[model samples]
Target: MSTPGQPKDPAAYAGPLSGRRAQAARNDHAILSAARTVFLQNPHAPVAAVATAAGVGISALYRRYPGKEQLLQKLCADGLRTFIAVAERHSDAQPDPFTALKEFVRGIVDADVHALTVKLAGTFTPTPELGELSARAGTLAQEIFNRAFEAGALRADADANDIPMVFEQLTAIRLRDEARTAALRHRYLDVLMDGLRSSQGAEALSAPPPSSQELGERWIAPDAIMD
Candidate 1:
């Protein structure tokens, strides 16, 4: 027997409680968007400032992002998601494994030139979270290279270990002051891919002759003169 003044059963409110949780998620996403804008404007912005920008209370900001590092991690993860989606789409388009790999490299280069990764890096130091994100990206990249090598798109004897090094160098060229040489970089990307292609009766192809190292040696001149 319920007293006249008694409240209804709390169990009757489960559906509304679930809806509130979903609404909280949406609000958190909005806060993240605001934080992202704030970070882009000032990578070192204080949490209070970001909360102000997001139009949320400081307590709410803390609820969603406990610290600067967590915010940075979320930003890096968001950027990686964009890149991974692009790579996966490109990978799906190629009919052959070798072509797919080449296209994948091209997509990465394109991303380097046009994606927000460089901009994000310019705004803030890469945190450990960013390093983890890069490691995950490396897994996809390695798979692409392996598929290319297995399909005879790369040199028959290309060292698997060296492939990652080459990729890091190539993709990183976009940050070079000399990346103004887009034509040159494209040429280099192609030349690097050619060297990786298997030479089993594959006629030796000539690429634009390699040039001197640039950007203080982070960018290697493509080896365009291999047989």
Candidate 2:
């Protein structure tokens, strides 16, 4: 007889175990890729849509993710982690703080994670991992902004919080049109980057902009206008 935790048929168990692990990994990759695509097209898309796109059964998807909410949470978590890593990489690689910030924004826009996350922002409560990632990203962004300011690369009035609002505005560009999306993002980002610079040509603001908290509230509720 086999031990309690051991398989009775070792050969059979080994064959299936290895195959199942490989198959599960493939399924996970497929599901995540499909989720990113489908959610990019429609953030409120159903789990059935994701399963269909993934070429997997609904049961298979549910086995990995209990529901659409769980899948969305996972997607957001993964995107946030990737975004943070990209930011860190750019920050470390570029000696000029302004160049680093520009590269970071370019990377994020190219990744299209910001648009997806913005679409799903209020749909689910953030998991601990997601929350932590967001907080860390925020801190990193602040550090980058500070460095840019000290280097005289950014306007004295600019705030780190303004970056997300710029991202939110950029997300309005139709991402489904890949060529147009790329062109528009680069064009607008150039304008935004120029506006952030401490050049004498920069226009002075008439009044103070909204706070980060105000931006958050307004972003989550598009219908609410901020004065």
Candidate 2, residues 1-227, lDDT tens digits: the string is: 32211112234334455677767766777788788778878877899999999899999999999998899888888778777877787776889889888878877777767877887876666777887888888788778778887899988788777787677677668756778888998899888887888888667766676686764553343444446
Query: TM-score of each candidate?
Result: 0.47, 0.81
Report lDDT (Cα) of residue 167, candidate 1.
46
Best prediction by TM-score: 2
Which residue pairs show collisions in model 2?
Answer: none
- Candidate no. 1 TM-score: 0.47
CA deviation > 4 Å runs, candidate 1: 1-19, 96-133, 145-227
lDDT value, residue 136 of candidate 2:
89
| Model 1, span 1-227: residue lDDT tens | 21111122334334555676765655566566666556655666787887787677888778877887677667666767555665667655877877887777666665442233433443334566656766666567667667777776677556445544444566545434644645566778788877667766765435432232221132112342235
Which stretches of model 2 miss by more than 4 angstroms? 1-17, 175-180, 218-227
